[model samples]
Target: MIKLLVVDDSPLMRRLLTEIFSAAGDFEVAVARTGAEALDLLTAFAPDVVTLDIHMPGMDGLACLDQIMLIRPCPVVMVSSLTAEGADETLEAMALGAVDFIAKPRGAVSLEIDALAPELVDKVRQAASARISRATRLRERVRARTGGAMARPVPRPRAAQRISVPRGPLPADGLVLVGCSTGGPPALDALLGRLAADFPWPIVVAQHMPASFTGPLARRLDRLCALGVSEVVKATPLHPGQVYIARGDADILITRRAGLLTAIAAPSDPELYWHPSVDRLVSSAMAQVAPESLVGVLMTGMGADGARAMTELRTRGGHTIAESVDTAVVWGMPGALVAADGASVVAPLDRIAGELMALFKA
Candidate 1:
């Protein structure tokens, strides 16, 4: 049976988590009331996975996470409250290497609570089954084996930046806007590594994931990309020379307030399939930046979130690019753009950044 560990300060919460996992029938559960208890438990148990609460007395979740990663490393799923502060701390845990998180319900026995049980169990199972990113683990292992500065790996060709277009030159102020899902990690890394460090415009991205995952995902991208990268905060303005990735599960829309651009995470009624909707951002950005906006590229994703926006932008005199089907993990988004006449250019991932730069020059 798979061994599972749960750490939470509340007795009721610990019991509830145990009961939920018990019904899954594939694992054994162990409980800890604090980080100290959790560490003691860990000394005696090699758990396959852990569910750690974000709030704990004496030793909070993040400190516990750092110790766990540094010592007996295992995949951890953070349990967090619904408040914004909870969201931020949950994000911190992910950046410190926690796998994923679940927001607690208002009432313990509420309908929402019951609904989350299956998802929690499944996440635990998946976390147990999956391997950590090879690149991340490789760096860690290098740091472990030798007390030396580990060199970052050399990236593949222009997978991140190559662009195709009917083109004049690219615009100088057209910062990159990237959208991806599923196989985004490695693909984005490859493409980002090829981008010029001084690419003029600030990059804005919308990737499908939960809010907690974005911060860590951005840090991972920062490690791989030459440009400065960080998770987008609510109302953070677009600035040249920095790349901002939208915090996930929110519809990322760009709005211009008195001539300045802000990345707005707005609530939506599920008109689109992907959280952090590319359509919302692209469509809204057109109005925000207007005629000055030169290019929008739709990368790998499962659905057509960006197609309508691409169409709107193309109709209004902006260039659009899509990733080629051959290299796309799931060509649905880019393919929709290609099929919809939204894309002015379609090429492999390698050429997009250069293509964008060319459009800027024109």
Candidate 2:
């Protein structure tokens, strides 16, 4: 059975969460009424996963998350609300090492909490199975933060660096499409950091996130990467040396105008599971660009959103890549691609950027 710790300030919430986990029969639940208490229980409980509340009387979820990472380094799933503030905190929590989040339904009461039992249980299971290296690193960072230990120098902005333009004419239809969910933020951060600022192909990214969170994510990436990164604006022209992130509330479509590709932001299809859906992006790219000119990458996520389209891309001569299972936080998205024989390359997160560059070179 998976061992879970449910931390919240509300006694009712704690009890409800515990009952849900207990009912699943697959989890052994431990309860804490606050972050401080959760920290205290970390040693004795030794939980495989934790469900953390964002707001508590003292030492909120973020603070608790920091402590848990430093002290135990286990999988943490944040319990958040669905409001804009909650979305922002959820993204921040994920960046700091939470594997995922469960958005509390409106009106935080026992009934509402109980209503989400299945989802909460599922997320706990996923968290328990997630790769923990990132969490371990986060723990070390927390230690450094508290101890004033030496840390890596922050990367400087590239404002003064000369931007390299593509040497020759822009490749008629070449494009790089990246899709990710769950552990996407850090994965995107690592991959984008590895690429040169003057990378010569236009790259588009679709990451499952709330609309309120995508802008912040783009800004964060812009600060961490050499390349300019921005949330997609409708009808914006796609250009090399910049990365475009799909707006989380809409699907970003690649459109050709006089042979130049541009992004068109459209309302998300109600039928789709994810806004800014990876499948929608890939399908649109395939329609606009030659198969040989496209490169599709499916990364860590919880579902098979991009697998079928990735397969089609591969069949038509586009290169396809998937994150390797051991390196993925969830492995479901990339695993689906693998199971469908969709990936031309299966690589670890650290190697994906280099692999893409090599493919572009060849």
Candidate 3:
């Protein structure tokens, strides 16, 4: 049986969560009414996974999460509200080592919790199997507390960083298409933070996230990395040294507009299981640009969203990089690509940037 600890101040939430997991079977469940109680159970219960609510009267979720990571690191899934404030806190929690987050129902009572049962169960199950690096989480917590002094310094932005280049002649530079889910945000930070300020290529990312979260995620990444990051809301011409994050709840596609390559937000396809579909993004880019001039990167995620398309990309002479199982939190997406013999290079998270740079140079 999978051991699970549900931490939330709301009695209703606790009961609902317990019922949801209990109904799923194979889950030995424990409940804590507060962070203090949760901490106590963290040792006594020794849960394989934790579902922590973000807000409580005292010793709130974030504070409790910090302690959990420092004391006994385990896979944690955050329960967050759908508001913007919730988005920020959830992102911070993910940075502090939470594996994934599920948004709370909008109403106060959240009587509609049954609607979230499947996703909650799946996320918890996935979290149970997720790999947690205690050293990395500790370092991240230290960096966060110390204003990032403990973190490696990213290069300062260049003088002429372009948010969106004018729609004119297309540049000769190729594009990097990145896809990730589950443990993506921190992995993205690690990958994008390593690139030099002058790295040549426009990177477009399709991270599975909700609409409220993606904007905040892009803003957070922009503050951390050298490259300017922005969510694709309109048809913006692609520019080297810029990173485009697909607006969540929708798909971002590459197309030509006025002879210039552009990133545009599109309605999510009903057929794709994951919104901001990676397959759609890569396939769309392939339609617009030569396969050899594109690069497909599939990172830590829970499914094979980009595997097939990236495999085709490799067959067509485009380069593909899969995050190796050693560094991937889940290894679903990248592992799929590797299994299909689609990856031109497979590397750990720390080595991905160097490999990408080498590929571009070659």
Query: Against the true structure, what is each candidate's TM-score?
Result: 0.58, 0.85, 0.93
Candidate 2 residue-wise lDDT, 256-305, digit = tens: 88777988888999999877899999999889888778888899988788
User: By descending lDDT, how would the candidates be arranged?
Assistant: 3, 2, 1
Tell me which residue pairs clash in candidate 3.
none
lDDT of 1 by residue, 1-362 (tens): 88999999988888888988898899899999999899878779888889999888999998888778777777778888766677657655654556567678867444566788877786677566434443453343443334223544443364432333355655555556677764454456556656778777888888877776677667766865678888876788778877788887788777776677777777753767677888777877876676446467788666687788877888788878888775665577888988888787787765766666666666
> Residues 1-362, candidate 3, lDDT per residue (tens digit)?
99999999988888989989999998999999999999999889999999999999899999999999988999999999888899999989988989899889887556677887899898889989999999878766776666444657443332211112222322357899999999999899889988887878999999999999999999999988889999999999999999999999999999999999999999999999997999999999999989878989999999899999999988887878898887788899999998898887787887778777876554
* Candidate 1 error regions (>4 Å): 1-165
Higher-TM-score candidate of 2 and 3: 3
- The positional error of residue 240 in candidate 3, measured at the CA in angstroms, is 0.1
Where does candidate 3 stray beyond 4 Å? 108-110, 147-149, 153-172
The best candidate by TM-score is: 3
lDDT of each: 0.72, 0.81, 0.88
**RMSD in Å for all candidates:** 7.1, 6.2, 6.1
Candidate 3 RMSD computed on C-alpha atoms after optimal superposition onto the true structure: 6.1
Better of 2 and 3 by lDDT: 3
